[model samples]
Target: MPPRNAARLYPLVLLLLAFVAFPLYWMASTSLKPQTEVFRVPPTFVPETWTLRHYVELFWLTDFGLLFVNSLKVCLVSTGLALVVGSLGAYALARFRVRGKEAYGRLVLLAYMFPGALLVIPLLLLFRQLGLTNSHLGLSLAYLTFAVPFVMWVMRDFFASVPVDLEEAALIDGASRLGALWDVVLPQAVPGLIATGIFAFLFAWNEYLFALILISDESLRTLPPGMMRFVSTTDTNWGLIMAASTLATLPMALAFGLIQRYLVTGLGAGGVKG
Candidate 1:
């Protein structure tokens, strides 16, 4: 607010930015460095011998492309399922008088707070029973454990914030409850849907433990665990790993940027409600 305070905060802001960005910078930088220099002492801040060999190896020699596709498939399908199921549940909670609604909502939140590692064993056993183990479907289903609750909570808040009068007017115009939601409420809730969908997508994209435990077939492995193919007890391919990490991060960064305008608008809208 004041020039003196602004000047004092600028340096601190820049320092925080560096702290957040340096790891990403290092990951990108290492991906470009020649293998011999990757582990060299006095680590090169910039690659002297920048090359695309690692990327070439990733696409041409490895199954990285397949892994990428697998990750994409899982993220899209799981996020879609989560959004569909969560939005419906959220709408019910927000719009109707359901008994024990608060208790049910709390349980959903608590389910999300449970550690993923603890769920893996029981999930594996459950999947085995259903013949879902080692399948993409199984992996996507496992992801729902966290994604659905998160989407439900967020969407519930957004749906609650929406004025009921809008949906009432739609209903008076010969619209059914579902029709009111589709025609009236959802249009206003677009920002929340985008934000929640993207969160679900990113969670599935970066998820490792469930993918690793649920899938043993190389073809089914997603990018996170698939990157481990580059490592062995003997040596690790740092360049390849860094390159893959950078590539994996790009789609997420791009998705966030695309929705950033709506996300900001949504945040501002949610800050104060009637």
Candidate 2:
């Protein structure tokens, strides 16, 4: 509150701002700069002349639109499946006296922690056998393995925070267990569910390694892998790459901004014990 304290905090605040905003500002600035201007002797922070060429080329010459749609589909479907299944599993874990509940939760978290790279080979082989290679559904299914456990852990904490007395009262009023969960418990857990959904969506949307290995067709590629195609061995189109990166990042930015409140709440709830 003192002037000296405020002044001391200003440097940290400025550093944080620079760290977060600099990359985004650079991406936008690079996207607008022409190829010659981009690699000019003295690097220019701002574009001397703005052009829509990169955006135009991206849409017209490349499969960027299809990649964007593909990424969106994977993120949405994967997140939806994760949240629905995770929420129910979390509810049961939190509310019911299932045997080895603690062990099960730990096992789920352990499974989630396994690196995607480790599973890629086996997953690819399995997909090949199932004829699911190059398919969005296959990618979505792969995403679920990581998404579900984190969602379950977060939602279980949220559900546990809501007292069982409310559900008991509903049961006394003749509401079924599922009805009570739908009507009473779920409303209280919206923030957690939204937070989990955002995590799942972002994970599925930005995934690159699995998409790279599983998909061979240009049409089936997601944004991250599709963006890589812009960078070839001989030359890299910096402007177009930046533009594509900007486009890919926008949805995640918008999604986080929308559900940030819930995300913060859910994260905090997960840290505390019921």
> How well does each candidate superpose onto the true structure, as a TM-score?
0.95, 0.94
lDDT of 2: 0.89
lDDT of 1 by residue, 1-274 (tens): 9999999999999999999989999999999998999999989999999998989988998999999999999999999999999999989988999899978876888987789999999999999999999999999999999999988887887888999999999899899999999999999999888888888898999899999999999989999899888999999999999999999999988887888998776655544432
Cα lDDT, all candidates: 0.90, 0.89
Q: Once model 2 is optimally superposed onto the true structure by TM-score, how far is the C-alpha of residue 139 displaced, in angstroms?
A: 0.9
In the range 1-274, model 2's lDDT, one tens digit per residue, is 9999999999999999999999999998899988889899788888998887899999999999999999988888889999989999999999999899988987888976678899999999998999888898998888888899989988888899999999999999999999999999999888888888888888888788988998888888888888888999999999999999988888888878887888899778765773
The window of 10 residues in a row where model 2 has the poorest summed lDDT is 265-274
Candidate 2 — which residues are off by over 4 angstroms?
1-7
Stretches off by above 4 angstroms in model 1 are: 2-4, 267-274
